[model samples]
Target: MTRIAINGFGRIGRSILRMLLTSRAEDGFELVAINDIAPLQSCAYLFAYDSVFGPYPGDVRHEDGAIIVDGRRIPFHSVADIREVDLQGVDVLLECTGAEGGRAEVERGLEAGAGSVLISGPSDVADMTVVLGANEADLGAHRVVSNASCTTNALAPLLALLDSHWGVESGHMTTVHCYTGSQPTVDKPKANLVRSRAAALSMVPTTTSAARLIGAVLPGLDGRIEARAVRVPSASVSCIDLTVQTRKPARVDEVNAVLEQAAESPVFGWITLPLVSTDLRMRSESIVMSGRETSVSVGGLLRVFGWYDNEWGFSNRMLDVAGLMAAR
Candidate 1:
């Protein structure tokens, strides 16, 4: 079994734990340890009762350093810094610590003896950045990997598939995402000036590097994409509106049929399901393309819509990346 440790207990970190525990036998992973700046009880409590994913679907109880859940007694290590935590026999550290998962912090996990390290969020020094279905070819014997941001997870596969089939000239993506931990519950003076306002009560527009990040996964598309985001007051689930200017103009039905065919391909995981974000609240698939909303212009512009449970699907993809790296 691939022994794993989670270095952060934020949304992505804890969600990964949930996926691993829920699919342990099928995925062949062993949960060894969890490291976080939060106290053991707080972390355990949060794990036991999450506001977003709802309560823990399985048994989870802890007495200090160790917690029993999903029929496993995993030890929890509370630490202000990942270097301070000791994870014995860890095969991979899913560094889901968001901003804390910088290049240096990831190095600490490597020094602490993790066989490999994969950032659950974006990181600068990860040897590879993979969007599982879109670019599994990028996975190799790299010591560090980045799963990229959740939005990147939603956009990369769609763009990669479209670019391959229709020859994309350029594209624009707007992610309509739900508010995350980085935002405040109420308005305040914050770093990202615009996001300083209330997270729950406002639909804030912000910049995203997902377009630029995808270049690493799909080099040919570099400098050819524009991306942005709007954080609305929803709990979870996100959608991406992609306008692709194809190399040659195609009919609406023709463009959609391409996506429909791509959906049949297992590698891309593009499902042409006629569903909205609410329909995908607890779903696992990364991109659930809305066949009804997919459209093509007379001038070769294709507008495609896709939805995903950002926390769940992205976490599952991260685990998929972990499994691939472990096998290599």
Candidate 2:
């Protein structure tokens, strides 16, 4: 089994742990250690109960020098610096600390004896950026591999299918994203202006690096895609609205057929359902094309809607990438 360690315990980290625990019998991974800056009490409480995802299906407590979630007795260690953490026999140490993860953070895990480090968020210094269904083939032998952001993962499969079928000209993507931990439940002191306002009370427009990150996974889209995000009050699942003028006039049926074909290919993670955000809470795929809502305007403009359990799906993709690396 591939021994794994996590360097953070945020939404993504806990989701990964939850997935691994639930799939222990089939997954080729083993959770050996969890290193985070949070206190043991905080980690215990947060891991056992998630407001967005509901309580874990099992009991949780601290025992035997570790936090036992359900029947798992994975050891936990709290440290101030990444370098201070230990990963003696770990095959992959997930750098789940978001912006705090990059080459430097990954190197710390390697120095302490991890076989490889997988970053759950974007990193400019990582060996390569992987968007599973799009360009996972771009992976290299380097130790640090960033899985990119949740938005980027959601965009890849949809964009790839459309671009291949109708030839994308230029695209504008608007993601109606749900609020994350980065936002405050109530208006409070924070930077970056609009985001500081009450998250549960307003729809806040924001910028995104997903467009730029897309080029890393799909080079053809380097300068052809622009993205914007609107943070909404929804607690979990989110969707992406992609508008594009195809190089060729796309017919409605043709577009539906294209997505339908992609969805049939399980590896691409496309689903042709008209489900809403809440319906996608525990979905494991990176993106599921909402065929029922997909439409092609008479003026030759194409609009595609894709839904994802942002937290759960992104974690699933991250695990897929790590699993690939482990197999290699």
Candidate 3:
């Protein structure tokens, strides 16, 4: 079994742990340790009873400095530095802290004895940024790697397939994302004026790095994609509104067919029925293409919609990448 350790027991971190506990029988991942600055009690409570995912299905309790799940004792660490944690037998350290400490943070995990470090978010300094179905083939024998961001993961796969099949001339993507922990519940002080206001009270327009990061993952479409984000009031699930002008004119049926065929794999999903954001919660696929919403303009301007559980799907992809790292 691949022994796994998690840093930053927040939404992503906790989601990974929940996935492991629920799918341990089939997945070869073992949760050995967790590192977070939060108190053990708080981690336990939050893990056991998540507002978005609801309560965990099995036994959950905090004993000593660890969170025990399903009778398995996993050590938890509250540390100021990543180097302080013992990763002796850890095959992969899922760095979900959302820290931009860059190279220094990755080296600390390796220096502390982790075999490999998989960052949960985008990292410019990491050896490679993998977006599972999009560019996981680029994964190599690197000590540190990045899984990119949730938005990037959702966007890359569709972009890859479309660009490969019909040829992407240029594209603009707008993600309707849910409010995250980064935003405050009520009006508060923040660097961005829009984000400083209430998080769950309005749809705040903001910028996203997914478009810029797309160039890093799929260099072929580097300068062709433009992207933005609007943070909605919902607590979970986000959908991408992508409009791309294809090099060749294709009908809506053709576009939907392309994604439909790709959906044969577990990495992608296809939905012909109308569904809400809540229906997408806990969805394991990186991106669920809304075939029902696919449309093409007279000028061959292709538009596609895809839904994703930003946290759940990305957390699952982290494990998928971790599995590859462990095998390597």
Best by TM-score: 3
| Model 2 segments more than 4 A misplaced | 23-25, 99-102, 265-274
Clashing pairs in 3: none
In TM-score terms, candidate 3 sits at 0.97
lDDT of each: 0.80, 0.83, 0.91
Q: How big is the positional error of residue 134 in model 2, measured in Å on the Cα after superposition? A: 0.8
For residue 158, what is the lDDT in candidate 3? 89
Question: What TM-scores do the predictions have?
Answer: 0.93, 0.94, 0.97
Instruction: List the candidates ranked by lDDT, beginning with the highest.
Output: 3, 2, 1
Ranking by TM-score: 3, 2, 1
Q: What is the lDDT for 292 in model 2? A: 76
Which pairs of residues collide in candidate 2? none
Residues 45-136, candidate 1, lDDT per residue (tens digit)? 88999888789888888877887786688878887677777755788888887765457767888888888888887777888888876788
- The candidate that wins on lDDT is 3
Q: Which of candidates 2 and 3 reaches a greater lDDT?
A: 3
Cα lDDT of model 3 by residue, 1-328, tens digit: 8888898999999999888878545688888889999899999999999999999999998977888888889888899788898889889989989888968867899888899999989898899899988888888798799999999999999899998889999999999999988899999999999989899899999988797899999999999999999999999999999999999887888888889999998679999988999998999999999998999887778999999999999999999999999998
lDDT string for model 2 (173-281, tens) is 9999999888888888887888898899999999776978988889998889999999999999888999998998888778878777776653344555556788878
